[model samples]
Target: MATTMDHYDGFRTFSWFADFVGLPIDQVNFVLTQFTALILAGLFRSSLSPIAATPAARHVYGLIIGLALGYFCFGRQAIHLASLPALCYVAMRTQNPRNMQRVVLAIALIYLSCIHFQRQIYDYGSYTLDITGPLMVITQKVTSLAYSIHDGLTRREEELTPMQRHQAVQKIPTTLEYFSYIFHFQALMAGPIIFYRDYMDFIYGHHLPGSKSLTIFYDKNSQEKEIVLEPSPTLVVVKKVVASLACAIVFITFISDFPIQRVKEDEFLKNTSMLYKMWYLMLTTMLSRFKYYHAWLFADAICNNSGLGFSGYDERGKPKWDLTSNVDVYKFETSLNLRDSIESWNKGTNLWLRSIMYERAGRNKVLFTYALSAFWHGFYPGYYLTFASGAFFTVAARSVRRHIRPLFLESQRKKTFYDILTFITTRIVMAYMTFSFILLEFMPSIKVYLYLYMFPHLLGLIAIILPPRLGLSKKAHKQSAEIDLSETISNGNAHKTM
Candidate 1:
């Protein structure tokens, strides 16, 4: 007989209404978690805002809520919660920056590997129910904290880059503070990976002084400049929450009917025409994106409700709300190229990879970063296949854009036509490339690609090889080799801004 862990459906709940209504157990649990966090955040903002303004109070409150939720969700297994603080303590103890980074990353990778491996062997099909997901979020936090500490303590101020200086951890936080940041309930689940400096700024209510109009005001009388607190924009939070919940409802209603596994069936491959197959793939990919859209938008709302995601003001002086936004729905949908599409989707994770991995990886940064991404996701062979294919896709797309894009730019009408063609091509290529990511198994993904005649893969190879021969210099292509990972971190500026 299969073990309970092997066949778990993720519907653990005590409410009779849930059973009576016959709701999906997984979705019910997800909604319960999101709503619970939202309510707690509102209470904290309204009733305890003054007390919670203090870092210590905020830390204690976060710890209590996080512990309670962990126990409620995972029971005795909540004991694993100790691992995060333990790792953070060890990182703090290692005073050497390089050593600290190495130790933290090693421990996090090992822990995540173990969890992912165990789940693969035992809990293969249960999506959104596994404890490993939360652990993965924790992995990002701990590793980032270690690197931030290294930037602050190990490297000289002059030696650091602008992004590095912005994220540098000036002081070693106490165990309590560290735990609070790691277990912050708002982003404890599907996260936007808040940086150490950003979290500290939120805790201390210190908005950085910049050229922007929305500067944080300070009291003049006090020698130590005290930050004036702004009221949490409840209206903005409400709008985002409502929108995200709607997206979630749509996904929950349709995702079951358009199951990704349907592509693997003989009827789907054999009976469908090429155009129909492509259209089906696009629809499946679009539906798949809604799941992420819901999670990310809901997470942003939770953070904003507690006044955590406020960055500054736009040119018109309207307050910007997206400090932890993960996806740009408009850019993701209308992207004319792979770079724009990838950058717009999972904005937070890409930022993490850029700041931590891509910048550090030297000559072969593109390949290195892609490999790290594959590793970070988990042990799925399909993940490796997708990333490997993506590497070629990037090379081909860059070649095409560089050599072909300039030819159409002479006329606005030509450029418009070019953009339209590229947009459609990008969507189809993306759907084909990411099909494996949803499938998660090697043979299924391979079979589906074979059925599609491996058109995109072959096209990508030809595109890369053909570009230079057509008089696009090797020098021109050399500049495109580096992944353009840098993006402004402010709201509504450009790519990668949350």
Candidate 2:
């Protein structure tokens, strides 16, 4: 009983519901698709257990559902989504085995960059959810899988890192398996970038906690032979669902009031006080994070609900379900160091960049990885500005922590005061960096930086330049005792806090 329409509207014709929800139809469509995926995840766990559903049937089901969701969200543009992955799969199977990884990486980046270029030309500054989001995720999956396959097939065991060894794909997957890994309904739309090995393990029920598929010791008397059952994901999924709704609520309530674009307006620049401007910058950026938090938490919940994200049990025997988590909410909010803050957010991208670029880059890994990150984000001038600044900022932050943090370890009181100062400094610096990232234009970002006097950049440069001139390295041994004592106290405090 489907109604005929003159054109394929990407399931974006829900104006009545949009009006009721007080959001654009496109956003409504995206939210509905996510919620629909959540529902399907529940059904996947309850009804399509490995005992009930064969691997082939599961693969076909996922491929069909994922493609339907793609078309329903992006219409004809979604064809690129399927075709790009299919092309990569073919290349992986037929291309020169020695160069498969490099070839696939080039193809994925080129295709994604072309889409980004087209988007910039056609729909610049529009915040509409589109095929590009999916393209970015697909690119990550395609490239990572290619690298893992190469590691498995081309490299010797001693050459591979422990993680690379575990995740490497020894055998070329069947077409069904490959498509299902990429287009699985739970992770297809937005991913935490599941590795090919992890996805295959999940599909085969090998990912379940305490599953007997991978026995470590054959000895019956072994202490590690105790059986532990898989735990239900109900509590974790419920918690994540609640967290997502809360983030969405905060976003809906505060996003309009603290619009980042307002900082660019003449009215705000002229009328707003400096203190108010600083406050607005921090608040707006903080609000901006909720959107990502909501998306990632919801996606993680979807994966967990389908029994995919189990890591193992904790020491207290509570199951840990964060294998696919993309954000560390507490550390993200409370970190006193820029490095920790950056690592806490968009964690999947950080891991992917570390694995695919940083580890492989022989020299200047940070610069290369940051450059690659900016490129992967697209051709936005503001992205380059932010990442370029980020590269320096990271180096500066690292240098400061090494040279200055030990100086504050003379007493617990001094350490606490230092933490307070750094917490505020880090937040302001993060907000300042994020301002350019959000604006996404050269002139606007530069204008805002000019408005703020561009002090963070100056401070970061000073942080980098002043340390060597001051001979901080010569004084390292003098502070070693204090640093050791401070570490002892901090570990005790951390245990107490936990």
Query: Which model scores highest in lDDT?
Result: 2
RMSD of 1: 4.1
lDDT tens digits by residue: candidate 1, 336-364: 88888988888777877777777776776
Clashes by residue pair, model 2: none
Q: For residues 390-475, write the lDDT of model 2, one tens digit per residue.
A: 88788888667767777777789999999999999999888887777888889988877777787888888898888657765546
Q: Which 10-residue window in model 2 sums to the lowest lDDT?
A: 489-498
Q: What is the lDDT of residue 1 in candidate 1?
A: 14
Cα error, candidate 1, residue 336 (Å) = 1.4
Clashing pairs in 1: none
The number of the candidate with the highest TM-score is 2
| Alpha carbon lDDT at 413, candidate 1 | 100
